[model samples]
Target chain A: MIRFVLACLVACGMLGSVSVCHYMLTRSPVTEPPTSIQPTLRSESALQTPHRTPDQQADTTVSPSRIQLQNNDAARRFFLILTSGFNTAPDPFALGSDGLTEPTRLSAQYGDKSIITLLNDLLRGESIRSSEFDVADTDITRGTLTLFIRATPAETDARIPCPLRIDLIRADGFPCDTYTLWTPGNGVMLTGEATLNPVPGSNTAALGWELVK
Target chain B: MIFRNIYWIFWLHLLLNSMIPCSSARAEPLFTVVASTTQIADLAREIAGDRCRVISILGPGINPHGYMPVPNDGKTVASADLCLQNGLHLEGKNWMATLVRDNGNRPIITCSDGIIPLHLDYDGTVVDDPHAWFDPRNAAIYVNNILKGLIVMDPEGASQYTARASLYLNQLRVLDAWITEQFHQIPPEKRILVTSHDAFNYFAARFGLTVRSPVGWSTGAEIGGGMTPERRRHVVASIREGQVPAVFVETTVNPKIIEQIAQEAGVRIGGHLYSDAMGPAGSAGERYIGMMRENTLTIVEALSR
Candidate 1:
C-alpha cells in the first residue's frame, strides 16, 4: 500500500511538468516580425514645394495645335526638295562678326558630333583661325543649333548677302548648294547680301543686310 | 528523453514548413505578352520570355501612329493579365484609353513615362514629339521597366525574367554599336540625313546623322495646319540652295509627299525605312534586330551611293 501511494505522487509530478511545457509552447514569442517600413506622416509644408508644379505651368508650356509637320504631304515634299536643292555654302555672316570684319571666334550648337565636326571643317575652309571655332552649345530641341560667330576685324563683309551663299552638307555626305527651280519666280534668288551674326554667348544674332526679297 | 523530445519537435517543425505551399504559391506566371509595336512589344517579350505568350498587333510594315486595332486586338488586350504601351500619347489616346477602360483590372504599362522626349518645331511652336523608340538606349530602360511589372505579377519567374532581360540588353548594345559602325561608311561630309517626317531626330542624335525634315515628330496632328505654304516655299528655297540628293520614306507613312518632293527637287527617293513598326512575321523586319539591321543597311546604301 505504501509503494502504490509513492507511484501516484510521481504520476502527479509528471502531469505538472507536462502542463508547464504546454503553457510554455502556447506562449512562445513571435519568431518573425514584420520587416515592412512604417510610413511617416508628412507635414503640409513638406508636401508642398515653393516651385510651380508641372500642372500649374502646363498652360505656359502649351503644345502646338498641329504637332506633326510631316502630316502635310505637299509641305513635306517641298521641305525635302528645298533641303536637297538649296545651296549649303557657309553663310558669309557666319564668317564675319558684323558684316564688316572676319570673325576670330565661332561657336556652333549641334547634338551630332559629326555635324559639329563638319561645321568646324567648313569654318577652317574659310580661313577662320581654327582655334576660334569651338562647340558653344550642342543640345537643341531637335538637331538644329543656334550658332554664334565672332570676327576680329580681319575681313570686311565686302560681298552683299546676295553674293554670299551657304553650302550645306547633305545626310548622304554630298555637297548641295543649288537645285533646279521647281516653283514660280526662280524660287529664292539673292538680290543683295544679307548678314546673320550672333552676339558672343547669346542666341540673338545681328541680321546681316541681305536682300533675299 | 528530454533531448529526444526536443529533437522530435525540431523535425516536426521542419516537416511542416517544407510541406506547406510557400514556394508554389509564390511562383510567378508565364504568359506570352504581345504588343502593338515592335519597339514596345519587343521589350515586353524580352522581359517575359518563356513566361508569357508575346505577340504584337502592329508587325513589321505596320504603323502605330495610324494603326487601327481590330476586334481581335481588343479581345487580346482585354484577356491579358497585363498590357504594355508606349504612352506619350503615342497610340492615339482615344483607342488606347478605350482599351484601358475595357481592361480595368489588367495593368497597362507605359514604357515612355520617364523618358525625356524630343521636341519638334511645328509652325514656330515647340511640342513634345512621341517617337522615342528610334534610340535603342532609351529602349533599354523601357525593357527594364517591363521586367519590373512582370516580376510583380509573377514573383516565381523573376529570375527567368531577369535572365531574358539581360540577353535582350546585350542585343541592344550590339545594335547601338552596329548603328555607329554603319554610319561610318558614309563620308563625314555626306552624312546629312533628311526624312519625310521628323521621326529621325533621336536616331540622328544617337548615330551622328545630320537630319532635316519639314514635318515634326507626331503624325496625329492636322496635316495642313502647321505645314503652311510659306514653309513649303522656304523648303523649296532650301532645296534649290542645298544640294541634297535623296530623301527617305517611312514604312508606315504615305510616300506620296516624298515622291512629290523628289519629283520637284530632282532627287531620288532613297528607300522605305522602318520607323514605327517591324515587318510581318517571316519578313525582313519581323524581329527587332532584323528591323534595325534593315534600316541601317538602307541608310548606308542610300547615303554611301
Candidate 2:
C-alpha cells in the first residue's frame, strides 16, 4: 500500500515536470525597451549617420552620368506579321507528300514599322505546322520562328463535298518555331469583319494579316 | 491487490513517459521555408520545416512551359499533401490542367489567382496576361497565396507558418525596395526594354519601363516570319537610333535573332532574361530571389553606365 502511494506521487511529479518544461520551452516574453534601441525613424537615421551627408540635407538632383551613345541611330519602324490558321481535320494523304496548295494561307501588308503577334488558339496537346501556307514575298526577320507544311491545290476535276486537308507538314516536320501549348484566342478577324475561310470541306483553315505602323 | 495495481500504474507511467519525448519532438516544426519554384516536391518540408519534408516541382531553371510529364512527377504530385503553382497560364495551361486533372485529392493552389494580370493589347484582343510573377509587387501576391495555402494545409503549425511567411514577406519587400533603388541608377530614358518576346509587360508597367519585342506576348507564336521588310527596317533603325540601349534574350527562346538584331543595330545584347523558364541551377538566376536580383543587377549595370 505504501509503494502504490509512492508510484502515484512519482507519476504526478513526472506530469508536472513535463508541463513545466513545455511551458518554459514555448513561452514568449515581451520586454520593455531600454530607450536606446527603441524603434523610431529619426532614431534609426541618427544611429546610421552621426554626420549626415550634405545630399540628404537638401533634395538636389545629382548630375546624372551619361553613357556615350555608341552607334546612336534613329528608331525605325519594325513590322510584325501574324497569321491565323489551324488544322481542324486530319490530312487526306497519309504518305505525307508535299503539295503546292497548303491547308491554310497567310498574307500581310504593312508600311514601315510594326510589331505583330500571331496567337495560336489551340490547346496544349494540339499541333499546327507552318508549311500550311505559301509565305510568298515574305522574309522572316528573326530566325526564332520556323514552320513547315506540305502544300496541295484545290481539285478542279470533281466537286468535292469538303475541301481536303492537304498534308502541309510531314509527321517529322517542325510545325512551329516555338510551340505555344495552351495559347487561346478567338478566330482571326482583320478590320473587324473579315474572317479566314476554312478549307472547303476540311476542318483546317487560314487567316492572314499584317501589323504595321 | 494494492501491489498489483501499483505495478500496473508504474508500467503505464513508463509507457506514457517514453511517448512524451516523441510527441514533444513532433509538436511543431523547427524552421520555415519559402521556395520560388513550383516544381519543388518538398511541400511538407517547406511548411513543416525540419519537422517534415517540403518539395517543389518547378524550381530554378526548370521550364514549366513545354515541360513534359515524367513518371516521377506523377509520384511527387501524388505524394504531396499540398501543391502550389503559378497559375495565370504561366505553367503552360497544359501543365496546370494536367496536374489538376491528375491530383483529385490535393488542392493544386493557384498562387496568382487573385492578383490582377496585365492585359496584352494584341491589336485590341485584350486578354489577361499570365506572366504576373515578373513584377516584384505581383510576386508578393504569389508569396501571400503560398502562405495561405501552407497555413491551411498544416493548421497545427499555423504559428510557425505565419511567422515564416511574415519574415519572408519582409525580405521580399526589401527586395522590391532594392530593385527600385537599383533602377534609379539608370536614366529614365534608358529604361526602355527590348526583349525577344513580350514577356515583361507586367514588369515594364510596374517599373515605368517601355517594352518592345520582336514577338508578342506568347513566345510560342511565329513572330519572325510575320515581320515585313518595312518592319525589319524599323527594328534596324531602332538599333541605329539608340532608342534602345540593350535588347535581352529569353531563356527558352532562341537568341540568334536578337543577336542578329544587335549586330544590325549596333547595340549590345544586354543579357539573358528569365522568361518562360529560369536560369540553370547554381547560377545567380537560379532561385526566384536570385533570378530577380540578378536581373536587377544586370539591368542596372548594363543600362545605368
Candidate 3:
C-alpha cells in the first residue's frame, strides 16, 4: 500500500511538471527565429555614399526611364537627344531648376553591370543626375537592346511637361538617315513595352522609339 | 520497493520530455518528401525551405531511362509523407509508380502536370518528351506543383512555402529572360544546338533556336531510344550543310556516338551539357539553375566562334 501511494504521487508530479514546462517553452517569444533566408533591409546612405562608384551613387535616386545599349562594332556611338517640351520658362507648376519638377533617377534591375553616365552638360544635382543620360556603345558582342521606363505603379512627368524628344543616333547629331528612339507625351512613368526587330544582313538592330502624347 | 518506483518515475519523466515539440522529435513522423530525380528533388528543396526533409532516389548524373531500383529505395518510398515524380515516362518502365503503389500509395505530386509537353519521335513513334524542365518557364510549373504539394502536406508551412516559391519563380523568370538574351548573341543561321539525345526540344523552342540530335529521346532500348544509322547520316549531312561549328555531349548519355558524329562532320565537340541529370555535387552543374547557366555558357562559347 505504501509503495503504491508513493508511485502514484511521483507519476502525478512528473505529469504536472511536464505540462508546465511544455507550456512555458511554447509560450515564450522568439526574438530571432531560425530561417533560411533573411531579407536584408539596408539604408540609402549605406549604398549611395559619395565614396561609392558612379553607378552606385547614381542608383540611389529615382528617375523617369533607363535604356541599355550594347553594340558589336569597333567604333563607339553616342545618343543624339532632341528636346522641346521641358518648358524651362512655362507657367506656374514649372519644373524646378530645369522646368522638370518632381525630378527622378531610375535604373534597370538587369543588364550589363558597367553603367554609362550622362555627359557633364546634362547633369545638374551633385548626386541626382539629369534625365538626359548618354547611350554609349561597347566592343562587346551583346546582341540585345533594353529600355525600362518607370512604369507599372505610378506615372510621373519626367513630372510636369516632360522632355518631348530623346533619340539614340549613332552619328554626332540628329542624322535623319539613322533610326531613332521616342518618348511619349504621357511621359515615361507607367507600363513598359518592348519590341524586337531583325537587322538585315547584320546581327545588330538600331533601337527606335515612337513619340506619343 | 519505494526506490524502484522512483527509478521508474525518472524514466517516465525523460520519455515524456522527449515527446515535447522540439528538434529531437525526429524519431516521430516528419514532413518527409521523396523525389524520383535530382532536378525535381532540387525544386522540392527550394520550395520546402528547411520546413521538411527532401530525399531524391536518383543521384547526380544517374540516368533515369534505365534505373534499377534497389531494396533500400522501397524503404525510402514507404517512409515518404509525399512523393514527387517527373511524370510522362521520365522514369524507366514506370518504376516510380510501381514502387509507390507497392510501398504505401503515398500522395504523389506530378511535377510536370501543368506543362504543355513537346512531342518528339521516339523510335519513330511520336511521344511526349519528358525533358520540359530544360526551359526555365516549364520549371516554374514544377515549382508551383511542389509549392502546392508542400502546402498540402504541411498546411502550417503554406506561407513560408508561398514566399519561397514567389522568390524562386522570380529567379526562374530572370533565367528565362537571360537565356533569350544569350541566344540573341548568336546569328540566326548559327543558332543550332546539337546534343546527345532529343532532350533540347523544349529549350530550343523557348529560346528561338534549332536542335539537332542523332540519338533518340533517351539512350535506352526499352524506351525505344537509340541512335540509328539513317539518323546519324542525316545529322552529319545537316551539320555539313549548315557548316555547324560545334556539337555537344550530355553528362548522362554516352559520349561515344557524339564523338563519332563530330569526327565525321569535322566539327569540334562543343563542351558537355547536362541533360538527363545534373552534374555531381560540388560542381557548377550540381543545381538546376547552375546546370542551365553552364549549358548556356558552353554553347555560347563553342558556337560563337
Candidate 4:
C-alpha cells in the first residue's frame, strides 16, 4: 500500500511538472511590442512644433544691400534673340511672309533673369545630358521658336540648375504667338495670353499679358 | 511495475508535446515608405496610419530645391517598399527621384499628377509650376495620389487607408474654404503680394492676388549671382508702379535681395512667408494648412491696409 501510494504521489508530481512545461512551451513566445505599437517616429503635432531659427527671434527689418548684376554674355545674346522683333514693333498677330506670325516685341524688363541665364546656358551648347533642353533654333524671321527645354525631375527636393518655362500667348492677337520664359531648374511653366501694347511716348512695345488658369 | 513504466512514458510524451512551439499570432510586417520631403512624408503617414512606416529624406527646414541625397538616404531608399515625390521638378533637378530610381525599381508615386499645373511664361517656353501645394485644392489631389499609392502597395490596408484619406480630404476642404474666406477680407486692389521669390503664383492664382518679386519663380535662381540689373530694376519698378503696400521675404531663401528691393522701393517688409519648403517643426507654418494660413494672415495683415 505504501509503495502504491508513493507511486501515485510520484505520478501526480510528474503530471504537474509536465503540465507546467507544456504550458510554458506551447504558450506564445514573449515578444517586444510591434514597431507599430511603439511611439510613432513623428506625429503631426510634433512636426508642427517649430524648429526655431536664430533669425526668427530677430526683428522683421533686415539691412539692405547694393543690387549688383552679373553680365552673362550668353544671357545677353539670348535676350537679344528673344527681343529681336521688339525693336520693329511688328504686329504680333499678323502672319509674316513665313507661315508663322510676325515676331512680337516683348518687354525685356518683364523677363525673369533666371530664364535669361538658362537660355544662355542652353544656347551655349551646355548639355544637361539628362533632359534635352538644347536650343533647336533661334530663327526670328519664321516667328516660330523651337526649344528642347529639359523636363523637371519628379523629385520634391531636387533643385537642379534648370529653368521654369513660362509661355505667353496673346489673347487677342490673331494667330497668337507664344513666348516662353522659365525659372532655372524648376519645371513651373506659366502660360498666359500675351498682347503687345505700344509703350506710351516710346517706339518700343511692351508685353500686355495676364496669367491664365 | 508495468503500469508505473506506462505512466512515466505518458509523462515524457506530454513533456515532449509541450516543448513544441506554436506557430500562430505573428504580427503583420509594417510597410516601409520613403518620401522625398516632409510634406509628402506627412501625407503618406496620415494616409498610412499604423499600416506603414513613412520616412522623409528632407527633414524640417531643409530646402528641397538644394537637397543632395546623402549615402544614408540611399540606404533608406534601399529599405523602402514604396517611394513618394511631389514631382514636376519641385525636387530641383530630381535628385531625390534619381536616388530612389537608382536604388530599386519600386513604384514611385508622383503626387503632382492629375492636377492642372500653374505655369510660368519664360520667354516662349511654358514650364510647369512645381509648387502646386500652395493651394489646398491641389493638396487634396496630393492626398488622393498618396492614398492610391498606399492601396496599391498594401491592398490589405485599403479600407483603412480609404477611411483615413476621406477624413483628411474633408479637413483639406475645410482648409480651402477657410483660405477663401480669409482672402476675401483683403481688397482686390490691395491683393498684391510682393515676395523674395515668385513662389506665390499658385497662391495668387487661387486667391485673386498679384505676385511680384525680384527673383523669379524659383529660389534656386542664383540668389545674388542671378540678380541682373534688369531683374532688379523690374522688381523695384513693379513695386513702385503697383504701389505694393509691402514686400515679404521667404523662409527658405536669403532675404537680403528682397530686403534691398523693399528698401529701394520704399516698402516695408510685410512678413516672412513660407515658400518652397514648410517652416520648421513647431512653427506657425509647420503643417501645410498652417503654412497656408500663416501666409494668408501675413498677406492680409500687410496688404489689407
TM-score result, candidate 2: 0.50
Instruction: Give the top-scoring candidate (DockQ).
Output: 3
Task: Compute each candidate's TM-score over C-alphas.
Answer: 0.51, 0.50, 0.58, 0.54
Flag regions of model 2 displaced more than 4 Å.
Answer: A1-213, B1-48, B222-234
Better model by lDDT, 1 or 3?
3
True lDDT of residue A97, candidate 3: 12
Model 4 stretches astray by more than 4 angstroms: A1-213, B1-29, B221-225
> Over the stretch B22-99, how does candidate 3's per-residue lDDT look in tens digits?
754344435899999999999888888767889999999999988989999999999999999998898988889889
The DockQ-based order of candidates, best leading, equals: 3, 2, 4, 1
B1-305: candidate 4 lDDT, tens digit per residue? 77778666766765665455433234444899999987788778888987788888887767787677889988898899999999888887798779888897667889888778888765456678888888766777788778878888989899899889877765765566567667878878788888876678888897789887776655675222246689889889988998889999888889899889999999999998888777787898767777888988988899887
A51-124, model 3: which lDDT tens digit per residue?
A: 22465333333122212223323123333233323322211111111112222232221134322222222221
Candidate 3 residue-wise lDDT at B83: 96
By summed lDDT, the worst window of 10 consecutive residues in model 2 chain B runs over: B38-47
Show the lowest summed lDDT stretch of 10 residues, model 3 chain B.
Answer: B21-30
* Best-fitting candidate, scored by TM-score: 3
lDDT of each: 0.53, 0.49, 0.65, 0.60
Tens digits of per-residue lDDT for model 2, A71-98: 1111111212232233332111211101
**Model 1 TM-score on a 0 to 1 scale:** 0.51
Q: Report how far residue B154 has shifted in candidate 4, in Å.
A: 0.7
lDDT head-to-head 3 vs 4, winner: 3
Between candidates 2 and 3, the lDDT winner: 3
Over 4 Å off in model 3, which ranges?
Answer: A1-213, B1-29, B122-124
